[model samples]
Target: MIAKVMRGQDTLGLLRYLYGPGRANEHTDPHLVAAWRALGVPDPGRDPDADLSVLARRLDRFVRPEVRRHVWHCAVRVAPTDRPLTDTEWDHVARKIAAAGGVAPLGDDRGCRWVALRHDGAESHHIHLLATLARQDDTNPDIHNDALRLRDACRALEDALGLRPTSASNNTSAPSPTRGETEKAHRQGLDRPSRAVLERLARRAAVASRTEQEFLDAVRSTGALVRLRETGQGGPAAGYALALPGDTAPDGGPVWFSGTALAPDLSLPRVRDRFAGAPAAPAPLPAAGPWGQAATAVGELSEHWDGAGQGVRAAGAAALGDVLTAAAVAAPSHVRQVLQGADRDWSHAGRPPVGTARAAVAVRMREAARALSAAAPKGQAPVGELAVRQALQALAGAAEQVTAWYRSCSWEPQERSARLAAEALRAAVGGDGAQPTLNFTM
Candidate 1:
């Protein structure tokens, strides 16, 4: 479950909107499932005669006229895959949210007044909670750190209520696409948001390059506009921003997104760490081609994960993404799309949770990535079917390891991504007429 909290000054406006049909007429059967003190608040949705103004006024009656933004609102939403929660279950959830926010404490009659509203028709099961900030005794409730508290409460609720667990509960996933980004992508006829596109490109560059200059060159090679932020005039770049050719802001300037804005690991400093103590290029491959060499290196990476410190494990996960991206770049036309899909999914699966200590790049896996990048044919050199099969098999093994690791940590989003990537790679291997074996033990 996830909770979004907002504050407003207009209690009546919020109440009316909650009870009325939503902007898209998506809200159905809008009615109160729970309210403060079991106060017998009138249900405007069910009771045609019940005035919304009356309920709003009652909720706000204890607040001083000078109290700005005294109306507290929170929306609690369950995962789409979770079973539908009954009104009774929703009431319990709303109460827990209220208590967590310090809006209304359990068993405290004098606590702030609040109401839980439920409506059908949305894709996900959700409830809206509205509360007045002032308590009955004229003291205002403390709402500091409410978001953190609500997050913790929801994690507990998911386990207690047997609901589908989510990565948001532990804040392990990447920053999700905002509503604005979604709408913008829809308007532009793009398959995904620009942020997502840029993030993928940045990851590919970070993995393929051994230095900042090489990283910039790699990004620009993809037809993305690059703007470097230098520490001083004519000095080395401290950070950089990227934008697609046609993506622009309202002022007609380029719509630039900094590396950090995409993900913490994409930040310039973090990207630099990926090449720390690394060779500029990989060692020459033996008679076996780059694809075969990368496959061997990737197959051996699981050993580093076992009995490794957090940093080493994190580096291994990240290096796997590098290898996937490199393979995607070098893959034959027939299997390139599948490899790209795996690369994209593995990007999320490989990211260390925020605040994890930066680790040195996994040397062997990074070398594999560099070799794959270096070996990519400049012309239309025919790619061997056997090489493609071997690469897919190695990628599948790495993804399975990632999935098991995330599952052990109870990180549902990363685990799901890794599992999906593994499935895609295995399917591709099968399509190439190879019965790939993943030997990694969880």
Candidate 2:
């Protein structure tokens, strides 16, 4: 499996992404340190100067096409498989990167500092890249000359190595998007935004809670003329939103982003309703049935959730549990209990930044457990032993990642580290239970 590690504010997010819902310093692992040195990018997380302010300036200059806020950042590490890479393969990979115009600034390294590094992990040999959105040459520098050459070389290299090309072939047409061409296309195929759109533009936009659900609900409420419905689960898991008449193309009609070429969950009808420019009624509150009632409801859904009602029931219970938990935690001492609830019981012996992450994980775990328990019928099993094994394996992974988040923390990443630890703990807990018990009797 290929994994992408996206980071924001440099050291601020690597832990959470790698380990799970936690903070981490750049020097999370010794191998990673060697990897960074091998790559040649400044290991800022280890250095004293790499504070939030330094990150602020860097992000402003890098990822933010808009005004930089809170070090908005992302990085993707592409490693295809877990086979041990021979020297020849590693060199070939390095050569391919160099051939692509991304050269290493540092000398005598296993991988180029600027381009990529092959990481040694359980799954595969993957490339770790820490990059900003900054372009090397903004002035349309000889696109035909350098770019064409780079693409051709890359294609040749991939073919030689028995690897698949990102696109079909080098003979494919070039990407020439002139502004004039876009305008012409607009004129040819379009009508103006409907009159309904004009009135619905927010007279005043109000920002709501930064909490994920609140933010998602806010976006969902936007009755765009075009919209994608949440599938499987709700919130982010339900997937991305495309508010047509809003998130839609400026010229009008459906316009999904990058790879969403197929029909999305957001239906055209839903978009039209939102085009009226009013918030939809909130999703109904979860029915506060008795524990047994809720358990039965959960069981019923889990058993038959697939095909007809897969994520629908799981998501509903998850969201309902969240509302209940959040409502219950506001009282005195409730916060501290969350911290103690999952303290240093695991190998690491310290709670992940047990504050912000606790609730988030709780909601997810309870939902999943309920779904699993509910899914297994009294006699008939829709899922097999393999499926249970797979689920457990996945859960183990989530737990490990959460542990990694805490393990990776360093002094420089103090705040972010704390935050990540908390989040990871929450996710691990949310994945299953805080005080999980393992029995060898089986």
Candidate 3:
């Protein structure tokens, strides 16, 4: 399940969109599944004579005029694989989430006015929750950390209702795509959101380069427009933003995303630390080749995972992400697609726990990344099957170690990512030079 929260000041505008056809004419039979009062509230979708203005005015009646953003909206969606829930079940889910969000508590007559709407169109499984912030008693409801609370409620409901379990809220995970982003991707015929594509390209660029300039150049080489942010008038670059060539904004300009927006570790300061902590000279490349060397290094870390401290383990996890990114860039076309998927999953798995200091163990893994980057084919050079197999075997082991490490920490998000990466790696190995069919959806 996924829940997104949005605050606004326009109740009428929101209601119009909710009851009427969606941006893509996707809303059909948009009826109220639940509301604060079961009997009196006017439902525009269900009643032929009901109007959007009438419904909006009723919801806003309790809200004070001084309250700038009195409208609270939350969208809840179930996983695609989950069984379809009836309108009654959806009403129950909405009530639970609304209570969790402090909008309308169960059995509280003084709670805020809210309604849950479900469409019987393309996206029939999910429902939209709309609530006025002011309660019936003319007091505002406590909404602090409401997003997190709603997430917890969703997790509990998943268990109670026999639905698919989702990852818990974590500061380290990348931000999920917004409704607009998802719609834009669908409109543009993109397989994933633009933010996701940019993040992957940024990760590859960050891992493949050793200097800030090189990072900038590598990012530009991928055809993304780059804008460097400096500290002062003429100071060195402090940060950067990226935008894809054809992806634009409502104002007919590029939609830029900063490095940190992509991921916490991708920030300029954190990226610089990756270079600062490494040895001055490049690590020696063995006669066995880059892939073989990376495999050996990964295997060594996996073997030592049990004895390593939290800092070392966290650093190793991050370093492993670098290895996967570099390898994806160097792999053949058929294998590259799967490697990219593995890299994406592993990215979420590799984030260090908050306050875990950087460790020196990552230096060795960074060396492996450097070697892979250096060994990437210039044109279409053939890669050895043995080398690819060895690398995949070692990566699978490392992913397993990551899975266990996250499981011990009881972090469901990273654990799931590591498990997915391990499965993809194993599948790739079993394919024997053929394209592996792996699900990349989150």
**What lDDT does the true structure give each of the candidates?**
0.78, 0.31, 0.81
* Strongest candidate by TM-score: 3
Inter-residue clash pairs, candidate 1 = none
> lDDT by residue for model 2 over 111-146, one digit each (tens)?
222323333433223334433333333211121233
Best candidate, lDDT: 3
Per-residue lDDT over 303-373 for candidate 1, one digit per residue giving the tens place of the 0 to 100 score: 55576666666777888888888888887676778878787667567775634344443677787888778
Residue 159 lDDT (model 1): 69
Better of 1 and 2 by TM-score: 1
Candidate 1: lDDT over CA atoms?
Answer: 0.78
lDDT of 3 at 293: 80
Model 1 RMSD in Å is: 6.6
Sort every candidate by TM-score, greatest first.
3, 1, 2
Clashing pairs in 3: none
